[model samples]
Target: MGILSRILNRRADPPRQTRMLEGASGKRWPSTPAFGATGSEVLAGAAQVRGRARHLRFNDPTAANAAEILRTALVGYGATLTSGAEETDSAFADWAAAVHLGELEGEIIDSLATDGEALIILRTDDRGALRLQHVPAEQLDESYTVELGGGRYIAAGIEYDADDQPIAYHFRPARPTDQYQTFRAPIRVVAADVLHLFRRQGAGQTRGLSWFAPVILPLNELSQLQDALQVTAKIQAMMCGFLIDQNGGATSPLGDGESPLDVSLEPGTMRVLPSGWDVRFTTPQQMAQSVELVAVSLRQIAAGLQMPEFLLSGDMRGVNYSSARTALIQFRR
Candidate 1:
């Protein structure tokens, strides 16, 4: 049986009768100790009164002698000479009990506030010393994050493809709106700083993309810059998909193409693609201009990626590409 069940059974049973010594010659038994008295107090009291006389007869000429005899009789009847000592011991026990009760009540109050349950157990150490121990509640779910950094290139986002391979993307240019005018420049590597930011957003599940229109630069200017720099650069720009993964990692570099989404060549003006579609812009350029273009291209590229209808209609901070696309499509329809 479980411990609680056994305890309940014991409490349900009737109290057992205790045997007491009885005889005409025996001294009167003292009243039983109060409820909740410690075992120490009960034992001490019994020892103190084991052999003491209550009164002495003085009329007898041999009263002193008789008193001594009565004392002996009291001893035979279970009286002792340590009544004062027993009283002091019982008072000490009472004080200890009061302190213990207060501590127990305080623990109960604390547990209630925290939705916790306490388990009390008795333990014995190697030295045979007995102690009472309290165990606290445990949490079933816990989470944490880790950050990793490398050089001046801060990781803008890390994405897992359909196959679950991690693709890390870095941006030299900062901010989503930076792509407005200069869409054809190669991003500056010197300006890039890599940082790994992690978080526990929710359960292990991929979230839907939030779309935004990215401005794409023209290809003519991009080719000329690539020729001048004598670098093999493929300038491409498109809306990209992004989301916070279950592990709180930011996912990006979305869309199909040779170049990462939201990047450009030095000379071409960036172009904005159709909403709710993922696109790619590839370019190779020397200098910090390419990095700057990458930062500014996110707006148009993200707008081109497909996303859930609810998210597109939801009240978000940036403009909703889905709504804009729907309006344009309605006019065409």
Candidate 2:
């Protein structure tokens, strides 16, 4: 009896120890723990940063340009829905058309490009017409949760079953853009009534990362450099030259060869130097290498977004027909 009990206890032993990550608060935990209600083990403090990136994609010029290019390229041609003899009539197509006004696919694709997901609410308005509203992912209450019969859950505004199927989505009762009437509870909608579209990268992945997430930092740096170059050029253009009396000569206002002596560097104004002073005009060096450097960064961004360089930069200087066709073919595929 003692030997049999020892064998049973040994069989019930837990698994061996594994590597762990130390949090900023000095708490050590496993990198991949068992699934919990919130599942914070995998995506600890990621949503806020992703939300900021979505905002930047709208305000940042480079991100906006890339997103726009993607939207136009991916959904420009539009798609056709075919029905067979056994299928129903054109009512479905007509209803979709009425809902989207000929830009259904484009809108959905735009949402994916910007937010990495799209929420579509299907309903009928007062006029009995099918109204399809595209809701921003930010509107979903990621922190909201409720206890029900099945088990405790981490709502994150979306409920999924064991098989990773979406069961329901909880939306904030108030519109994000609305400024008034702040008191409202969350509204839950079944999965059948709404379409939540996203590209899942893994078996248990739930949240979506913005398409611009990877290249955001690089794009912002590039934009800042370009802006600095423009500002430098503008300042150089606004001022012609400086009158300097390097030899400790007369410190009075100087005149140019043709114009009167002046101290200001305003537009259309030329300065003349004293006899002992010299007028030194800055020779602006051509940023011949900047074009190449900017192109390289853009290429990286394009690669990250799975976009072609020519499409984002609109540069065809060195692109021949063969190369352009090949690139387009690959991008299309």
Candidate 3:
């Protein structure tokens, strides 16, 4: 058959059913922001996120407690390396004691949660026994990379083989703000000598982002709300004063007067105002529902933290035993 004749004889395919939003528009999805980020791409913000996370860890009690909670829940008192071979048992004990395994594990977990990754350099003692040196995550900048030609490549400070496996890591000098360090080349360490710990969020992702990424905004909101409420309470408390005119000659402070009379409210002491003088306080009532709102907000943060709300909040008023058990079971898993 000729080409034109064959084309005219082509079969007509039936249309398939499709499903989509019935009436989607900007009004329906007001802000549809999206990020097409790979694992390596996400590390671009890891440094900032890690800095904020660390700041919160130090200055904010809630954040500090959350890190502790995660450490406790995951590592607890840590594990013992006991296989029970005569010499092996003794060697394991010495190594564990030398490294302070329990404390080291907890620190590593905290680093993973706050810094998004734990950079531990493996070293050997004089006897060739293993040793570990924990380095700051900030020492490794994601911008560090080298194209090694062919399929092998160094990306985001990590060197990968042609098979796409990490072969080594390149770490910048300790002091990032130093001009000399900034200009210096990063130190390259083989993957075998370095232990990189992180919880990968996506497949083929080269690096991990802070676990707090999901909850940072919510946490900041909660912190700011609490601060606002605290300031309001303080203002109300400090302004709560009684006006007095012992001689009743000070006149009404609202009208033409020398100055507003200040009266102190002392404990276990009382002072009666003179006649024709009245005390009025500038007390402003705060929102009664603020407590409930905070509780609800904390629950939202708790969801992001992957823990039971009661555990995060220490509020067991509405938490039942069965519910607590279920939540803990899920968290433990």
Evaluated with lDDT, which candidate comes out highest? Answer: 3
Q: What is residue 293's positional error in candidate 1, in angstroms?
A: 55
> Clash totals for all models, in order?
63, 5, 0
Task: Sort the predicted structures by lDDT, highest score first.
Answer: 3, 2, 1
lDDT of each residue in 64-156, candidate 1, tens digit only: 232233233223323123457888767645643644534543443333222222223344567664443333211100011124433222111
> Highest TM-score, which number?
3
Cα lDDT of model 3 by residue, 69-138, tens digit: 8888889777766686778888777778888988998999999888888999999989888888888786
- Give TM-scores for every candidate, taking all chains together and pairing residue i with residue i: 0.14, 0.73, 0.79
Model 2 / residue 193 / CA error / Å: 2.5
Better of 2 and 3 by lDDT: 3
Model 1 spans with C-alpha error above 4 angstroms:
1-101, 125-130, 139-333
What ranking emerges by TM-score with the best candidate at the front?
A: 3, 2, 1
Per-residue CA lDDT of model 2 for 7-78, tens digit only, reads 877856678865454442233445645544334522443465566566767777777778778777777766
